[model samples]
Target: MLSGERLSAIRAKVNRAQCSQNKKSATLSSVSINGDRITERKKESFKTANSFIIRGKIEENETLTKRGERSLNCAQQRYVVVVNGKAHTVFTHRCRSRHCQNCQRIKAFVWQEKMKEIIPELSINFKNGKYLFITFTVKNPKITNLRLVLKCMSRAYAKMFQRKAFRFVVGGIRSTEITRGKSGDDEAHPHFHAIICLKTTYFKKENYLSADEWGRHWGECLEAEFKKEGLEYNAADYPKGFPRVDIRVAKSADGKQEITNKNIAEHGDQLINYVLKYSIKGSDLLKDGKADKWFWEFDKQVKGIRMIAPVGVVKKMLADLERDQFDYYKEQEKIEKLIADDVNFKADKAVFKKEDDFDYYMESKKDRFQYIIEAIEAKAYNYQCYYKALLSDHLLAFRSGIDGIIENFKKIKNTKTREGFEILEKAEMGLVKIQCERIERLQFICDALVRVGLYKKMSDFEYVNIHTKDKTTIAKNNIVGVMKAVEEKLLNDFNQDFMRLENAKSQDVFNTVVDRVNEKSALIKLVRNEILAAGAYAYDADNCEYIDLETNERLEVIATIE
Candidate 1:
């Protein structure tokens, strides 16, 4: 069956087919190798960034500790989230620190989503109106004066709006942003970004303010505030007495007369994202091999500052929308809890490699052990550097010890007074201090939540009169008992003073009794008002329940109004 020429041709064809298959296999192998390298590089980059963040946090914590201030620590206490494959997906944590890059990214995403929902409403409401993006800036200030500069900037913006010409502004959003200055300038540059809603009348030639006029008005306001604050002003430093102020009319994609809903949404999204960017860049904190002075000072200055605020109609609408959303989320959570037993959902466990294990795993086989040892040394060295830096601050060291001593003294006083007549007086004083601190901390948390539009403000809560029904339980009964105890204490103090006044032993005794009654009444009333204001409810004798005015679920009442 084999002809010589035909057999040779067939052999050639077979050889060609084999060669082609081999080539494809080689190509695939190469591609697989390249992909592995890319993934490795990505993992390395993530680890490096994570390490930097951890180091920065440690340094910040050290500084704060030295100054006897509250700082974000507890690196291990992170909210871990796993996504995708067991080995394929990179594990991460929700650090939730203000200066964390990962947390900031998540925050930005949340902000974008919220803005996306709200922007369409804004477009519909102000269909006939025009939009403008205005940026108000001030000269970069030294780290020491950053807080004051920020205060001045805020006051100036408020003052500018108070002017007769700015009466046309209906609704707008304001965000305070700070960035590190580069080259030949002080580091902290504070500015304001405002998404201004303008009436149609503002588009007219007569009413329109050019960029130059905006700069001038901004400068005047800034300068006046600066003078009032007694801050040094140099005409040469800022020839215009203010940093650059930019104003641009927002336009549609096609540059047409009528702006579309899509255009408004996109524009609003961009402005909000820009405004909501991290107050301080993480990179600025730990640059190169050392932490910058600016980072430490900036952290101290920005404590308790409200970085974002909405004004006018936008504020009211946003508040109402947020409240509704919060309620919806709460209801959804309740439903999920109810159905949790029936739902067969499997959650993927996040696998976080320990720092040492990660380092060892990432190393090449040839020098793995050596690399691990070096990595350990490097980490130890970094900690030493942080410790050294903290020690260098003499003032912080002195201040830190003072707080410790005071705390120890308080503890000692408590133990020593256990067997003495003065025990009640000391205990009462300590209780007062503890109560004050608790109130302050609560207020701080509430303020932060309100600032971020996560929770309703006190005034808004009062307006809504939102209340939660209480259930019958031992815990609930105990809460009721505490409330009664508090009430009884107040009544007993009042009754004792009244008896003393009735006796009228002497003029001095009568006056003292009267003063004591007035003081006790004022204190009791103040405490009751504060509890009610914070959304705690009084016990209802008829219902045999203590309803909660703050939250939807039944919770133990720590305090209540009369």
Candidate 2:
């Protein structure tokens, strides 16, 4: 009887186990192949761009169904690129991170594709096309004055390109690139790289002002514009400091720089490519963004109206306006209206007087040659270079103490270098050697002189005769004159024309003599018929100062009034 009960219990247990297996099998059979809804729901970030979408190659963002599952067919995709120059290939990839630099290549390619539609319509076939890449850079310690610098640059460039003088079609198509430079500040100081398309067939980018007759045209246009605004566009009086301003024009491809003082920006397709290099797809300085933080703040009142922008940005903007010639705010109001209207307007936009355009606005009034007489005055010594070209190619030689060549004057007759104050005892140039002839003429007076040395006083000076050698060589005598030539050159080279020679004992030494003549501190004292050294003096029509380059002396001699 006991054995029979055990057998019945075991039978009941087997039947329950069989029922559980049947239920589990049913559940497994009901499972759907598209099991993971999360994977299938992933959003695809791509537009159906113009090109053949090789179906197998593109990531369609579809379901994988299971691990390690891929599409039944998969291959690589190809794209054809026809630009102004040549055709190329484009491959697409995932931009894993927004900060990734590699992604820019694909982004640029896509932009090119979009631009193709536009370039075909806007561009006219020019015989030769060139692109000029113009960049507006700010000075170092950018955090302190970055915004003001940028504002000035923006005004200057926008005015330069958009003004009636520049006359490009709607400010030309512009692309913007912003970089922080190597300084590595949190501000990532902003600068702009502009690609200017200059239609060479119609609009020549580079015009030779020094050699060709183009300089007069360039100067006239600039002068009229500056005069209208009461702006001082004197090259001699442009501001001096770091973040030095410069503009370069060269062929769109590898070529020599354009030295001509004209609007030499290249135009057309080649220009487009060069411009695109800087006008790429990223910027640290954006007015608004959906991905990162950007602030529009407001402080203080403008005519009882509130203002807004990032505190630092607005602070800089206001400070920049303050730095201008007090008309900054009124001009800013004009720009505000333009900005509201979304049209390009600049300070150089045929504006009015008592308030010069931006170039003058940027240029502080306290420059060296603000005085009209000073503009034409012969320099004592070279502080930098005499007659620096503010617009065109003014050659400069920057050694410990050398300045570049001023136009037509390969060598200053007797003017000295401000840096070393070493008189040009000799000079050698292409097909022209001036100091040699001067050295020959100086031989006539060498017997009267004691010896030649650097910044040494010639003691016991007696009146002596010197000779000058032009096409006709003739000897001449000189009594009292000043070191005008030497002083001016020194000032031009070093921007310190009057470097006084001091006696350890006498403070009056400063008034008595200076190694350099043209320094702003250098006083020009006029005596009698003979001009004195280190004193404020001037010459009349005939009885004037004669610069003896050989001895580096300035002499005043009697002359018949012409």
Candidate 3:
């Protein structure tokens, strides 16, 4: 019953969809899961840094106590769940949804499933409910140089079973790791979490090495590997510390940390889920409930990334995680998925297909791309090239890794100056009308200040702190300009406060050498490198064997009154 025109339109749509399949993104893969790409920028917001930092402590799941293990399994047996506040109870063995499930054993079940998929070679035997949970961590280096790191790690993982390399007796070794191509905050930095299996025989020779020791060894091994690649680093000089490797272990009975990271490489059943998590479009930035508890609006509206941790929220997560235990991991996973869902909505909100320039282009793709894929189930095309020049341009415009720019902008709050500072402040927010006009006016003033002869010594632009879109440049400019203004003001103040150079004259002093003590102007002794100024009180001078200021306390570069 369809009209010929409508049918033609449908066919064209199908052709475009088919052509999309052959297309490739410069920084992305073609795979998609749950509407989330394998590794894409998370599109969402956040107002604080606590969400990820303090919660880092919960990275390791706990081991259950001997007595607790029995109860944990018993609790996992068939149970009833009442949806919401409803009266009727649904017959169920256990709830895996981290929040509503009683005993919430799904975390364990999920782990089991994932292990089989990712590390099929792992030989795990939980006898008497004793399963050792191990975790691995590593510091991320300059993101641009990831090839060496990944290559080294791959080698190390493969050599785990070799006693000569690791110096431990272990057999049946397997490695399963989950790598996040970028961070949840939307910074495209790579990091990996790997889980491995080792023979139980090594525990007998050097048993009780402490779980921390294991983590340290793992970190050290990675360090050695990085050093080989010349990618190792020292964090003592960085303003904010980077991530480090951790080797924490827990017994299967003890898995309690309220923070559930779905990307962890513990088990394999969640392979698709884990893979989707690494994708840029799979973040949970949009949600009305607890998941949307934090983040700034602009971050959400823009690329849907850049959520930092708030001080208060970090404290709460820490307090809650301290009480986190193995008995509740399953419940946390559900909450995590919901969070993931929220982030995904924001990531995929807009899709543009260009590569070189951050702009959309309309170019014929009949030659470059072989086919284009539309959604999941669209028709195919063969004559079209697999890659279209138009798609290449789209990829280039989608900016996700330029975090250095954002970091620099964060420093605007420190600039000082009225015209210059205010202008920068207005620019930081990209606000409307009045503020925008003020910024423009300031720019004019900045240009004029340079041209004015009176302030010639001061550069046209100087460092200043003002909250603006580009705070870094404003701060740098304001500093020089502010200093120039201060110097001129000081000169003017000095001219008004005292006699002029015309009144200069010399005075003669009589050599009245007095031998008495109290009358000799306190008889202070001379000091080496002693600071003396118009208002400085020099009580603790050098050669002062007995001075009031020369106490037993150690001297400091700058002194504070006690």
Candidate 4:
């Protein structure tokens, strides 16, 4: 209805306003939505990572169940202690399952602390020493042959170090690690990282071996030892093969870093920590969605193997330090004590009490200690009763089995003559093997019983010496004497009947043994339930609950009253 120029001008103004409004809306949306999206992504990624971790644990548990081994059920259960209002300390009841991430982290932390102390001592002792970081490797082994390959590699490593070339090596720390190969390469890679110290003279231009030369030497030694051990080796995978060797000169300082004793010690700590950080990577086992099959195989293979070995003077030094520390800790009742005089005082501003005041504090809190000890004693008593009954039953079977073996040996001994001495010797050797194996089994069982808190201490059980005249006679008599002594001791200590049916003509012996065992089992269950119940209320009177530093969320205290 208006003129063209006027209408055009109004439309243009409206368009400009609309554009400005759109820009404002876009700015606001981006500021809010973009930040929210980033946060959501981060949370989602964390959740996904945790899912992978849990999946790995679930797989490990399944494997354990299949193999009849115990799985870690209480891996996340922690005992948290809050010091006044300032500090929070977290403690875990470590399950020590081979693949537990939390347990591994704790072990790594402890190892690092120990290494820190040991490194400075090394630097002082070996003032003119040169260090070398060496890695020894072999071809990636299939899951089925992982154990054999590891054994072969270990023996080879020992042989290599014993070679004349290694005589100049003064001390070293060796740690073994295993990792799963990348996606397409589906094999377990097992290798060793060693920090070896050498005399200063070994680094002389004429004496020094180049990195490549060192690699060649490693290969030759590994191959020769593997061949000697009757292990199969691929000729093609040698000299320039999959089993690569790495050798580097370790320095006390790098780049422009000034050389000082502290720096040198720190350098040594870094080298040691790098190798010992993980014996096996938990993340490698749970790559993608499922657990790697090879990792499980590797775990099973190295069950009882020692992954770290400190050799030469380092070994002795570590052993001495460890012994001293152990003795110190064992004698000290309270390793850590509260800093403040009052429970409600804040730790940040509180002054720590002197050692003289420790006894007074402990005396004041004697009730808590007494409560924990009583609970432990009650549980231990029940455990002892249960084990006594269980072991008594086992002893009966062992006695009958050993008796049969002795009877066989007796026949062989009685029938032996100087003319048939060779036959007698063979029979005696066979019997000795059987006896030693049986005794070892018994020792293992007894040790387990002690470890499980069923027994306070392990009793020494002497074995018969088979390398003597009248060996068979001595062995039989010793076996009989040992069994009789064990039976008597069990009865005396446990205050329970052994139920020697051979001596009892009563037909009720079986029923009597059954009743006793049932009674012990019931008592064990009752005590276990009581212990669990008491544990809930066993908080330290001095220590409060731990609070998460970041979230400021308070964690429930699971203090050890003892």
Candidate 5:
């Protein structure tokens, strides 16, 4: 009912709006999730550390680039979840590097949660146990000797704990922290923070270790260990002929009360977090945005070394708990595997083992289209149909299997269980393989159709929008681009097999040629489908597009037949 000019103006507005929407969708789809993109303040935590490591001069290590890349890409891909009508980005992949700030935060949180459970259990088990917060330190060592100093310190700690004077104390937790000492940039001050569990009887005159005695015992142990490590320990360098050791009653966050078993769970959070914090503080590492000599040395010194550990009773209890959790997961995996294997067995029997008349029909037919179709239908069935079904069945079982594992993981995420995140990762990997395999199969069909002149090979449509973020170019976005990339990867081998298949005339030779194609198809499947369904670009073959695995949709793409 509107005038022509008004209608034209309105249509123009709608077209502009749609173009804007498409652009926004393309940008959002470049990341892990799509749909009204949730924006949040991302912490640039890895920037400083990653720059430091990659820039710092180190011995020729093969893993340096891989390490840098992992850290650089950590948490870049995130899954979007909606809660209460609000969208938020959830946790994704992490490098788990020693100095990664994000990983450190997660590690500290897990430890804090663990201590909440452990402290209360230990307190109840050892009714008369008294908790003591202890700090064991040594005179600053040259930066070059930091690794040796840490090794000696660990040995000394172990030796001191095993001494007869320490018999009254049960097990505890120990964590190492290193700092650039005030002495100079070339010196390192490494120390241990421990929450020691002691029997109430330690307060008695006979079993108690005086402040001076504790220092002396620690000094003796350190001297012995330093000597064993072939390093000279000069008592003259330290005040009072020994390094200083600080001892105090473990207190709640509010300093009003000492933490006992009854209050440990509630009060132990602060102490636990402090003890389980990162080995080197971020402020120390990224101070002045410079990677100094001390920082570089510290990174090398602590490589592959464990900075935190449980001792004595704490060690035993945790080990038992882990073992129990492991057994539970193993039992669950066994049951799931049995069920999955049975299902896969039945599927394989029904599909591959059962004979069909399709091959006979192909043997009798003279048409190349029918032969190619029959070859495709048979080879494709054997190529991945069972594998896909098996993986799909396994993926479902893995999700069901990980319920208990996920709960346990919540309590302590670093705990590795075969049936936990590992299985989930495997299932996800299988899914990516299936996606790639599905695309490969479709490409194979389309190529065969093109050979027979039923479908046309086309080019001219870009599968993804040209976009950039932070100066890094993202890979292709949609399924069509992914399929083309996959095709290119397998192009050489595919060329050889495809040419041979095209020359075949006899049915026996045809089956043999198709076998080669099947062999190449089964060789490998891609796993880069993280942003698979991000774009609306579907592969174009004769103006027909296959959008989803189940639905074949017709899309008129801007393309020219080749």
Candidate 6:
């Protein structure tokens, strides 16, 4: 099914990617600080005097709350988990503040991963799709007017996208970058860097737009937006014509090689990284190791602006990718849960095999608990990853666990005999016991997070794990009580059915009523027995009634088990 050339290309790409990852890991290890692999770039950005000055500025801002200040100071300490001499950052406690360079790095990495997923699908789905890197710019505006310039640019971008000449454009990823001019911070140079996906036919004469044509269209759009906003557009000020708009094929960072459909899967990262790069260069913000008035104003101007966006088909593709990823993780969690509870299950050592098998520590525990911890620590470092792929959000996890309990409770009514009812009740309890084990796993992970400094205090763990356990416990008891009530009502209806049988005019009719009563009575007994076995109720054989486990109150027996 595969051509040799393509298959070899893929294998080569895989090897290259592996080598890149190994190199990055080595770089991180070399710069490790306090058990964390904080890169020199990130350290310079976050630990420098500039960051402190920025924090001070944030404090002076009267609009920011106490919580907001704390968030702005996020990632003061990095939290990580160590496995086999390697460190992985599980939590950076990022505030995602516009002024934070570390968060910008994290955001870029997230977009890189997204592009890896999006590119291949787009290539396969839209066979004729090709990429073009375009830059649209306007004349320099004063720093004070930068916000207004950005607004006009956004409006113009929307207008251009709807034009007839751009009909072949499926979608694009656009990012706005602002820089300071040579004259200093007084003037701002704002521009857009976009990688647009276009149909192959766009290269034809009918659809193609040359560099001058693109500049003209962009200039017209800007003029229209400026007029709409009641700002004067003076064409005579620019004797050289409208602002320049550069349009070219997407290429490598060095601008030597073009990325075609065939090679996009391997080289698309270059194009993606360029477009999703930092909105403002770090040097521009931290000039001379100080926060200038212009820097602070720029931060406020772009406070809530989305730096990068995927439009049209790109947006839809991203949504579909997210849903698929969600379902995939959910199914993986289900499988791992099943494997964790299988008493006789042994993790295949082959899966954990490495170059030095003798150094492996995962075999230290006999139970599947060790296997689970190994899988968790090896795969995920942060609680966000843990929650997304394994544990889910607290409320959602509790609801899912309670739902499992109720589904098992409902199956009790399918039993047809007293002995079968007792057996099924025991089996269902065994299943619910597995759900309880997950709650224990949640506690284990919470303790690990608190120990690693992700959670500031043990009380945080209690608030999550303890509160969830209490809610689940309450729901379980309530469902058990409801099961008991339903069983009682069903038995009463059966008794009436039996009484009506006594007045049957024929022996056949009486025998039919007796069979129905036996079936209904067995189902009621099954439901009642399950409630008792759940420990929510206990049978007081002497009084021939059920006792509530919590309140110690007596409840009428629904159906006796012979």
Per-candidate TM vs. native? 0.48, 0.25, 0.25, 0.48, 0.50, 0.56
Per-residue error (Å), model 6, residue 10 = 29
Residue-level lDDT tens digits of model 1 in 325-385: 2232332233334323422211112222343332112212222123222323332343334
lDDT of 2: 0.29
Q: What tens digits encode model 5's per-residue C-alpha lDDT throughout 139-224?
A: 99998888998999988888898988999888888899888888987888889999888888888988888767889999999999
Task: List model 3 lDDT by residue over 444-480, tens digit each.
Answer: 4433322221112233334232223222121122222
In model 5, which runs have C-alpha deviations exceeding 4 angstroms? 1-44, 49-62, 77-89, 323-562
lDDT: worst 10-residue window of model 1: 80-89
Q: Which stretches of model 4 miss by more than 4 angstroms?
A: 1-63, 66-71, 81-90, 183-185, 238-242, 251-263, 324-562
Candidate 1 CA-lDDT value: 0.50
* Superposed Cα deviation of residue 379, candidate 4 (Å): 15
Question: Best lDDT goes to which candidate?
Answer: 6
Candidate 2's residue-wise lDDT over 1-562, tens digit each?
A: 1134543443343322111222212211122222122111111111111011232134452221211122111101112121221222221223322222233334444444343333432334332334444444444323433344334444444444444444432223334344444564434344454543444432444532121122233333444554555544453432432233233454424455431113233323354454444221323322222112221110000012211111112123323442222122232233233223322111110101123211101111222112111211111112112211210121111111112222212233335575322333222132122332332333322321212100112222222212222121112212122123323443444333222232324756554343333322222221221133323343444645644444655543422211
Report the backbone clash tally of model 3. 96
Q: Rate the local accuracy (lDDT) of all candidates.
A: 0.50, 0.29, 0.29, 0.50, 0.56, 0.60
Q: Give lDDT tens digits, candidate 4, residues 171-274.
A: 77788888875533557788999878788788778777776666666777777767776777775866665367788777544534432334556556566678
Backbone clash pairs for candidate 5 read none
How do the residues 228-262 of candidate 6 rate in per-residue lDDT, one tens digit apiece? 87776777655547778888898766777777666
Cα RMSD of all models vs. native, in order, equals 19.8, 34.8, 27.9, 24.4, 24.6, 16.2
